[model samples]
Target: MAELYFLIYVIVFIVGAVSGLLYSYSIHLEPFVVKEKFNIPILIMAIIGWIFTLNFSLFSMIPSFILISIGVFLIGFVIDMRPGYGRKETIIGMIISILIWLITHCVIL
Candidate 1:
């Protein structure tokens, strides 16, 4: 069961990463240029998700995930919309965090 949950997490994470890449491209954010730089943030999000999964029950985790994801999205949106910044690393971070939360909480053992 634990293996299955991990598998689901990996699948979701990959999908999220790809989606983030596409989204960045669509907005002309040039993810490829800074792809290597964002690795630490993405890894941090995954670590946070893993910690949440370990500490909380599925029922509790769902709402937390939703709130966290929404917050991350809003932050990312705001950053992208800022006049001078023009970065989209937040989108990638958001995707990773949300997908990790979903996969970790949704899997039935």
Candidate 2:
């Protein structure tokens, strides 16, 4: 459906924006803490949206599922990058995220 494609496009745009926003040395962007509770609303919203679309003839739920998965992965990435976290853990987290992203796209999209 068009909504699925739209969500996929939005996700790609968001990742690109995040990459640039999180790494702007000229702007002196500082990393901030992201509490686990902060993501709960988004998680709930995604799930609700997916459930709402289940019987509808409009949006497909696959892209929303993928989006929510990536959002969770990004939260993990932020946690792993926080102070006192080991570099190995950050690397592993990123690797796992990449795998999940690839598998989700392959299996769902």
Candidate 3:
């Protein structure tokens, strides 16, 4: 189950990567998805989702993950630790990652 859980998380992360390519405005009737990959940080920040839902049942993991996430973001952005970092896409990834948490909590252990 844990293996499957992680695999699902990978799929969710891919969805987030796709979301990163999308923009609010589109060129003509198509090309809303950007050709340039600008959201590498978003894809790399997949751990954020895992941390976000760590507290669904385990209270400690939740708070710890939240703190760690904040620290990573702070260090990454404030210190410019990472290049090609996309905040928006990372946020999207975090939201999408929650699906795994929901599934684990509601359907599995």
Candidate 4:
């Protein structure tokens, strides 16, 4: 039962990682490889956190999303505190993943 819910997160993680790799491109920011590495991983973690909280009704999703966003950003902030870490891509991916999750649960089937 609970294992099935965790399986959802595994799928989401794979999707996030594949997207990060598939869309890797050069940008004036840091580097796209950083996006594939740091960005996607953080997004994966965020999604997993969201999925775990999803045990509750949709009413709790909004708050779960808020916390997930905060946690991801805080992680990016801390990671960026170190030199050579890319926060921009991490934040971007985090936003994108969360939006997709929100819409899937809140809007579309």
- 9-87: candidate 3 lDDT, tens digit per residue: 5555455444433422222234343345544543545445434444334445545534444434432331221223344
Give the range where candidate 2 is weakest over 10 consecutive residues by summed lDDT: 49-58
Per-model TM-score on C-alpha atoms: 0.35, 0.26, 0.34, 0.32
**Number of colliding residue pairs in each model:** 0, 0, 0, 0
Residues 1-109 of candidate 1: C-alpha lDDT, one tens digit per residue: 8677556555555555455555546655654443344445534544454444443354464765444443343343333332332244445544665665668667633
Range of the 10 consecutive residues with the lowest summed lDDT in candidate 3: 74-83
State which candidate, 1 or 4, has the greater lDDT.
1
Model 4 RMSD to the real structure? 11.1
Between prediction 2 and prediction 4, which has the larger TM-score? Answer: 4
**In candidate 1, what residue range of length 10 has the lowest lDDT sum?**
77-86
For lDDT, the strongest prediction is 1
Please list the residue runs of candidate 4 whose C-alpha ends up more than 4 Å from where it truly belongs after superposition: 26-109
lDDT score of model 2? 0.42
Model 4, 1-109: lDDT tens digits are 7676456545555554444333332232453334235555545644544443332244464665444343433333323332434455455545665676688777886
Candidate 2 TM-score versus the reference? 0.26
**RMSD per model, one decimal:** 11.0, 10.3, 12.9, 11.1
> What is candidate 2's lDDT per residue for 18-101, written digit by digit as tens?
543443332343465333333343334333333322322223654555554454434433333334322333344446545555
What TM-score would candidate 4 get against the native? Answer: 0.32
lDDT of 3: 0.45
